[model samples]
Target: MKRSAMVLLGLVVVALGLAAKQLPGVDGGPAAPIAGPQVAVGAPNRGSESVGVELGPLVIEGRGTRTTSVVGDGGTVVLAAGYGVRTSGAAPALRLSLERRVGSGKWESTSAPVRQDEHGLHVSTPPWSASGAAPATTIAYRIASASFIDAAGVAPAVRSRSVSVVYENQAAYTGLAAQIYRDAAPYCPTTAVRIADLMGDVAGDYQPGTSLIRIDAVVGTGAMARPEIVRSVALHECSHERQWLNYDGTNEGRKRMLAAAAAQFSSYDPMGVGATGPSGPLKSDIRPIEHAADCGAMALEPRGYLGYGGSCSPTQLEAARRLLTGGRY
Candidate 1:
C-alpha cells in the first residue's frame, strides 16, 4: 500500500478505538482557631474529621479531612482556620503548616495558605504529587497560633489539631502534569489530572464523578516509557471529560452518556487497544466514543501523538469539532 493508503488505514485502525500503542504515565493545616471551615476530603478519596482548640473561655473548633492513600499527582490538601482573640485578649497569629513524609523519610515542612474570617475560613494547600517518593508517603497538617508576634514577628507557637494521609509517586512529575492540564484548558479547565502507574498496558483513563483525568506512569509500555505518551493519553482522557461535562446536567443526557461510556469500558481490554499496532482487534469495529476522544485530544494540540493514533479519521474529527466547538455530540 502507498503511504497515503497506509495513512487512511491507520485512521480506520483508530476508528476501532484500539488506537496506537501503550502510553505513559497532598497536605495539611493550622491556630486559637475560631470556627474553622468544613471541607470533606472529597469522593473516591474522601475522609472526615472534626477538631477543637481550647482558647480559654471561648472554644475554637473546626472540621478537617484527609485521605489515607493518594494515587497520583496534582492531588491537594486543604487547611483552613479563622482568627479570634485568645484568653490574653490579643489577636491570635495563626500559621498553617504541612509536614510531609515521603517513603518513610523525614517530615518536610511546607507552608500553606490560610483562609480567615469572623464566620469561618478555609483554603486549599498547594497541589501535591508523588513521582520518585513512594513506598510510604504521608502528609500531616497542623494549625498553630503564636501567643503573639510583636514588631519582630517572634512569638511562642502552640500547635493545634492536624490530620495526615499517604501518597504514591509524589513529586517531580507535578510540573509536567500541570503543563499537560494547562494545555488541556481549552478542552476542560475544571477537570483534574493525576499521574500514577496504572499497573497494566493502560496508560490513561477518565473517571466519572471525580472529574479526574489519569495519566499512568511508565508501567509495561504505559505512560512515560514512550515519547508523547503522557500528553497523548492525558488529552485523550480530557476529551472524555469534556464530553461528559455536557451530560452532567440532565437525566436523559446522563443516560446517553452512561450508555456510551459503558460501551467504551466493555469493548477494549487494557492489554489490547492499539489502533495501528498489534493490539487492534478489527478494522470494522467502530469505537465512536474513543475516536471522539482522540479527535478531541487532537483539537487541543496537533503536535502530540494520540494513543489511538497520531491522527484521527475525518468523521471522528468532525464529530469532535462539533462537540468541542460548541455543538452537542
Candidate 2:
C-alpha cells in the first residue's frame, strides 16, 4: 500500500477502536456512561476515578473528593456524588447519601443535597471538619443511594466503592517535597527527612564521608513559608548530595569532578562573594561545586528565587540546562 493509504488505514483503525469502546456491551443493552470529577476523602490524598453503578435502568456514578492534607488552623473533607439515568422516558427522583469512617470506627452517614441537570444529578456534602489534635490520620468514605421512585414506586439501591484520604501536618511542604523527589528519583533518591530538613539551614549540608545530610543552623524559620526559596535551596543542596555520592570516595575523583564543573561555569567566584581571582587552590576547587549547585537550583526551578539577587547569567543558565539534561555533576 502507498504511504498515504497506510496512514489513512491507521487512522480508520483508531477511530473504530474508540467507537467500539463507546458502544454498549453485547450481553447488556446500551451501557450508561457516568462522568464526573474524581472523589477524594481525606487529608493529603487525592480522589480516585469515577465509579459507575447500575441500578436497573438508572446508571449512577460517584467520585471521592480531594483536599490538601495540611491542618494548620483546620481542614475539611469534601464528598461529592453524581449520577445519570440510563433508560429513556421520565427520569426517576433520586437522592444520595455520603458516609465516613475513621480508623476502626463505625460509619457515620450524612445526607447530601442533589442538583439535577439535563445530563445527570450531582450532590456534595458540607465540608467534614477534621480533628486538629492528631498530626496525621486516614479517613475512608463511601456513597450510597436511596431507591429511585417514580409513579411506579421505588427502585433498587446503588452503592459505590470505598476511597480513603490521609491528612497530615505540613501537607503543602510535604507534597511539594514528594513531587521534587519523584522528579529527581531516577538520578537522586533520598529520604523524606532529608528533604524536610532541607527547609532549615542546619540540615542543608551533605557530609561526604558519612553519606548523611546534616542540619546546620543556617536558614531561618520564616524562610520555610516561601516555596520558591525552599525549592531553590533543596535542588541546590540535592545537586551537592549527588556530587558527594559520586565523587566523595576519592579526593582525586572529587577534584576532577569539581574541575570539570568549574571549567564549564567559570564565570563566578566559588565563595559566592564578588571576588576577583581566588587567593588559593582551595577556593579554586570549591568554586565549581558552588557553581554546579547554583546551576542545579536554576535548572530545577527557573522562575524560583535563588537569593543573591535571584538571577543567573546566560552562560550559567545554559550550563545548568546541560548539567540537568546531560546527568552530570
| Best TM-score among the predictions, by candidate number | 1
Candidate 1, residue 12: Cα displacement in angstroms equals: 20
As a TM-score, model 2 comes out at: 0.34
In angstroms, how far off is 108's CA in candidate 1? 35
After superposition on all C-alphas, the RMSD of every candidate to the true structure, in Å, is 13.4, 23.1
Residues 55-113, candidate 2, lDDT per residue (tens digit)? 21221221112221211112232333444443223544456666667777987786555
Q: Which digits, one per residue and each the tens of the lDDT, describe model 1 over residues 1-329?
A: 89988886665434324334443210001111233333221111123311222321211121212223232344453444333332222344455444445445665566665555554444444555544435334566455544544432344554545455444442333565665666565655545557666554455665432345566544113224233544556667766665555664222344576465434432332232223453544444535566567666665556545555433545545556666655555
The local distance difference test score of each candidate is: 0.46, 0.43
> In model 2, which runs have C-alpha deviations exceeding 4 angstroms?
1-186, 190-192, 195-203, 214-221, 246-249, 269-286, 307-311, 324-326
lDDT of 1: 0.46
User: How many clashes (backbone atoms < 3 Å, residues ≥3 apart in a chain or on different chains) does model 1 have?
Assistant: 24
